[model samples]
Target: MSAFDPVLSADTVDQILHLYATRGDDHYGEDVSQREHAEQCAYHARIDGADDALIIAALLHDIGHLLHKFGEDAADRGIDTRHERIGSGWLARCLPPSVSEPIALHVAAKRYLATINPSYLKGLSAASLQSFLLQGGLMDAEEMTAFLAHPAHQAALDLRRYDELGKIVGADMPAFDSYAPMIRALIMKDAR
Candidate 1:
């Protein structure tokens, strides 16, 4: 996918929102709805000073879950139908690497975190744990070694952090509007 193709336009965001609004009711686990989760991710990314692409990535990361119709069983089956891969591919058609790569890497980040932080693994659901192994098992020592060689490691790490914190359930969750300007600024800057 060309970097320019994946750049989120107003229509793209609208399509995403509509997709979530219609399907958000079918959530599998956790009290937070999909829309709520996206908002939380975007909010946290902004708070962490993430670039616009990263913020958009956070907001749209899990959209695959809604888009692909995967259930907890499929997610747990270690099936290649993992939402990250699916979502990243879909996003790649419309957005740039700045957005798509992190979404693509977020699942790997989950595995990476699971390997390094025992506590992180402990917090995962049984399905998530199984899927983690199927997805790559902390990416293997060799893969991890190679992954760490990249400059984007820190950005991927930060995206992972936002991914985790974004799942909280509560009325107190931050709003998405607050981060819209930042997202716009980032996209505009990238366009330049």
Candidate 2:
């Protein structure tokens, strides 16, 4: 069954989240469930004073990881899975570009981060580093200038940071339902 309809009602959001109730980045070496990571990212975004839109984006950023039936170790098997694009495309139907844009661009943001700062590469977790290599190591010279100018560049980078930070295990935070108001309101007023 589809977790969401043409428009995202609150109930559908919960159904979508159910995909996370059972799994997350476990095979990728993260200790948190998908639900926890989403909650953590949203919580951090809220604390960082992001507006409701970005917070909702953060909360739902990795929902693609849940929707696909990829093996937990898909990256290990050399499958990129392209969760960013999948999640963003699925979300674009119900979310504004303010949210879906960041979700779509975050992986590119990681590649962008690696190009600008070598130290940033050092900070990536094992699985992240592995996927980074698969996604594209560093942007080439011409790509560098263009990537820097992308309008979604900054939001993608910010979401990437939250994506990494949200993986910490065993944290207590509000559940998915806690953001229902934001989720309900921030969805595209006109469904795409």
Candidate 3:
């Protein structure tokens, strides 16, 4: 069964949690599981004083990887998977643009950063490096200019930074449930 209903409800939070609890152990070419990466990213966002919406965005940023049937190693086989679009589309059913837009643009933010800061490219993980190529390699001046005009540009970049830092093998982080209240509140607020 799918993790989410076609419409939003109280169970929406549970469905997301169930996804993390069940398939979150799958890796995305990193040492940590999907759940671990999410929690750690969220932890960093919270510590960095991100607003609740951005924190939730950080937590669910990579959810596209979990939502799809593509094996965790899709990037290894030279497939882009487009998890950012998938995740953002799925999340837009209930989440505000504040959350979903950042999730959608995070990969773009990566490309933007790597284009402007060559050293940023050196810091990407092996898996991220592969996917980066598949995700358009680098942004030219035109692309960078367009990316800069996006209202969510800064937030997306912030989430991308947290994403890079979230892949530790073992880091102290809160569990998914710890953020459920925030998630639920966001959902309810958006639904209204």
Q: Best by lDDT, which number?
A: 3
**Which stretches of candidate 3 lie above 4 Å from their native place?**
1-7
Computed on alpha carbons, the lDDT of every model, listed in order, comes to: 0.71, 0.77, 0.89
Score candidate 3 by lDDT. 0.89
Instruction: Name the runs in model 1 displaced over 4 angstroms.
Output: 1-10, 76-80, 125-127, 174-192
TM-score each candidate: 0.79, 0.87, 0.94
TM-score of 2: 0.87
Report the lDDT tens digits of candidate 3 across residue range 26-112. 885789999999999998899899999999999999999999888987987888999999999988877788999999999999999
Candidate 2 root-mean-square deviation in Å: 3.6
- RMSD (Cα, Å) of candidate 3? 3.3
Badly placed stretches (over 4 Å) of model 2 are 1-14, 22-28, 188-192
Error of 3 at 95 (Å): 0.8
Better of 2 and 3 by lDDT: 3
Local distance difference test, candidate 1: 0.71
Give the CA lDDT, 0 to 100, for residue 148 in model 3.
95
The candidate that achieves the highest TM-score relative to the unseen native structure: 3
Give the TM-score comparing model 3 with the true structure, all chains together: 0.94
Task: Look at candidate 2 and tell me the lDDT of residue 110.
Answer: 89
